[model samples]
Structure formats: structure tokens, C-alpha cells
Target: MPDRPRHYLRQQLRWMRGTTVRHLWWLRHMPLRSLGFWMPVVEYPHLVLALLVPVAVLATP
Candidate 1:
């Protein structure tokens, strides 16, 4: 676990970036019938929500 909020956010960003890159690569290289082609549907929405939660929390006054 991260020792601070900044570290946690940085880790989440890294995970999000890696997941996005992996999805892009899968879209380019994987067949439509493969699990890789379908993984983003399972994973991407959660990542977007993870991203949004932090932003929402920070945006609140």
C-alpha cells in the first residue's frame, strides 16, 4: 500500500496508463474471438470509475 495520498494516486495513474496501453495493443494485435479482445469491456469501465472517484473527491469543496 502507498504511504501517502500522492503515492496512491501516482500508483493508480500508472495502473491506468498500463491498462490503456495494453488495451490499445490488444485492439491492434488480438483477434476478435480472443479473450484479450474482450478484456477491456470487463476492465476499462472500472478503471474509468477509479479515475473519476479521485477526481470527484478532489473537486468537492
Candidate 2:
């Protein structure tokens, strides 16, 4: 595995962690039902994009 992509991914995850904490703090201010749909929408894409971008780039021949 290339170190660069993995390193980049780690950075992304770190950013996502901070973003998630901040976002969840805001989410707590919203209604419960709003959280059910919105949390996954905001969170999953960050995690997936963080993983997907590095893999797709690293996987390139």
C-alpha cells in the first residue's frame, strides 16, 4: 500500500472527527426526528468520501 494515500486518509478522518463533533453539537439543538434522517446523511458521506477518494486514487495503475 502506498503511504501517501493512507496518510491523506488519516488526515481526512481526523478532519471528519472534528467536523462530526461540531455537527453533532449542532444536531442536538434540532428536533429528534430531524436528527434521524439528517445525521446519516451528513456523516456517512464524509466517511465514505474520505475512504473512497484515497482508495480510488491509490488503486489507479
Candidate 3:
């Protein structure tokens, strides 16, 4: 476990928190069905990308 990955993950989580809050606020005006569609389209990729940070660090020397 290196400082770089920890820093990167922290930064990404901070960004994700802000974006998630903003998106939740925006979603309030939309219909419930839209959540099902948007969750995968927007949220899942962010999650996957965040998860990949660790895998990428592991893959490196």
C-alpha cells in the first residue's frame, strides 16, 4: 500500500461525494424509473473506476 494510491482514492471519493450529492438533488425532480436507468449509466462507472484504482496499483511493480 503506497501513499499515491491512498491519495488518489481519497481525492476520487471526495469528488464522488460532491457529484453524488448534486445528482441526488437533480434526481429529486425526476421520476423514480429514471433512477433505475441513470444509476448504471452514471453511478456504476464512477464506482467501477474507483474500484479499479486498487487493481491498477496492484498490477504495478
Q: Show how many residue pairs clash in every candidate, following the order shown.
A: 0, 0, 0
Q: Kindly list the per-residue Cα lDDT of model 3 for residues 1-61, writing each as its tens digit.
A: 3369888899889998997777766676666677644674587688888999999999999
TM-score result, candidate 2: 0.41
Give candidate 2 misplaced runs (Cα > 4 Å): 1-3, 29-61
* Stretches of model 1 off by over 4 angstroms after superposition: 45-61
TM-score of 1: 0.64
lDDT of 2 by residue, 1-61 (tens): 3369888898889998997787777666766678654875677788889999999999998
Winning model by TM-score: 1
Q: Write the per-residue lDDT of candidate 1 for residues 1-61, one digit (tens) a residue.
A: 9999999999999998997898899989989999988888668788789999999999999
- Give Cα-based local distance difference scores for all models: 0.90, 0.78, 0.77
lDDT of 1 at 33: 94
Ranking of models by lDDT: 1, 2, 3
RMSD of 2: 7.8
Candidate 2: residue 47 Cα off by (Å)? 9.8
Q: Per-prediction RMSD in angstroms?
A: 5.2, 7.8, 7.6
Rank all candidate structures by their TM-score, best first, as comma-separated numbers.
1, 3, 2
Off by over 4 Å in 3: 1-3, 29-61
Task: Give the better candidate number (1 or 3) by TM-score.
Answer: 1
